[model samples]
Target: MLATTHPQSGMVATSRIHRVVTGNGGAAPSRGDTVELTVSHLTKRYGETLALSDASVTFKPGIHTILGENGSGKSTMLKILSGVVSPSEGTIALNGRAISPRTPHDMHELGLSTVFQEVLIAPHRTVVENIFLGYDGPLRRRIEKSARAPLAQALLAEISRFPIPLSAPAGELPLASQQLIVLARALVRLPSILLLDEATAALDYADRDLVFDAIENYAAAGNIVIFISHRLEEVRRLSDRVTVLRSGHIVETLERDGITAERLLKLMAPEAAIHA
Candidate 1:
């Protein structure tokens, strides 16, 4: 009970705390040591509808916001990231290895995960079933249903900061809650990279904030997060870096310090930088 007791130690013991310091006081994420995914010169085109064009980006361990208006090809970029669709031209690297995902199944095998704008959970199934919907006789090699619910709960707990009712039907939940469900499902794979395509469009301000907060955490854990959002204000607030896409081409990539709502809008404006 002395003043200098170790149990209630003063600044001396507290000062010995183990703080995780980056290479330079965490000023920037250490890309060389911590990058999870790399995308270079990616282009996607479907029968003359150019979705992306020569887009090159490196996703470090941080949340990156893709800023674009509708039809700006942001969704195309997300789809490419998740391997939901093939790119006309580009290279993607996961875990420092190059991979060009030609199919959704291929990307999943490579640890590239995503949640699209639309929710696709089975309406009649329970949350547990929804989580394990794909893990059946084919994928899991006879994984029993009895063992799936607890496993789903564990997976949910890994990424979710709050308690989710495992018994509820995912389709019955509100839009925001269902969005969370999709996010949780993607995280179940414990992927090295994550892609979000307008996942927060239906969310209110508070719910959007909650999801973005989770995104920050996910990125901090050394996972790459590629997010596309049409909400310019949210783009500025949530993204560590912003990539502006206009008509399938990356107009610019701005750091958090360099981007603003006015600047972003001006860059996206029809009168700002357009070639007819």
Candidate 2:
């Protein structure tokens, strides 16, 4: 969640999150297991523009939804978390140890992975090759077609209920299939923190359900899943907690019970009170 001082109250609205654990068919962690990630006093600047200012929030093992209008610092916050960019001023800690990631590879090594809003895939690459793009080490290497095919097929089956050809060129697949492939690429890593920036925007209804189920199972296994989406209904459905950002500041942090669309819209755009 983004952070700022209250306009009239002159107080910082620090987020107070309550964890509610549910069983994903008994795959979820035990109720008291700790998987805390804290981001405090984060700020990012680009030349004269301030993208994020004083954003602070703590994420635990659950599905967290980030809500904001365009330029409200949503993507900036995710980028900082995913290690695509460094925060101008702030700290990120897992449990109690402070850590900084300077690149996407570094972030992944620290148990963080991201699926961005854009569809990213090599057009000429086969689905299996694209899924295992960077994991070329000896133990996990897929230098041969026969070796990669089975593992890629298994992962694709686990994430998507629909059938996708593992041998098809990525460019030849539909947009929805390509989106699933992107998700497969990330899920193959089994990162502790999965950041999804509008990941489901390109998915069809069935594929969306498949992805949401995968998200639930991932979070259930004691990992953190942070996502941003404009679809309020999907947010309400998938989020265990929802954080609203506005103008580079956090407006509200709501638990599952508080995440009504009307209330969320009201908090997101307080100036449009009549419509809210």
Tens-place lDDT digits, model 1, residues 94-142: 6678887778778766656788889878877778767655443354433
Q: How much lDDT does each candidate structure score?
A: 0.67, 0.77
TM value for model 1: 0.76
Give the 10-residue window scoring lowest on summed lDDT in candidate 1. 14-23
Q: Pick the candidate with the highest lDDT.
A: 2
Off by over 4 Å in 2: 1-34, 138-147
| TM-scores for every candidate against the unseen true structure | 0.76, 0.84
TM-score of 2: 0.84
Q: Please give, for residues 1-276, the per-residue lDDT of candidate 2 as tens digits.
A: 222233336554311111111111101112223457899999999998999999889998789999999999999999999888999999999877899989988877666779998999998999988887775554844245455666666667755667788888999999878888888777666566789999999877877887788787667556689989999999999998999999998887999999998898888887785654
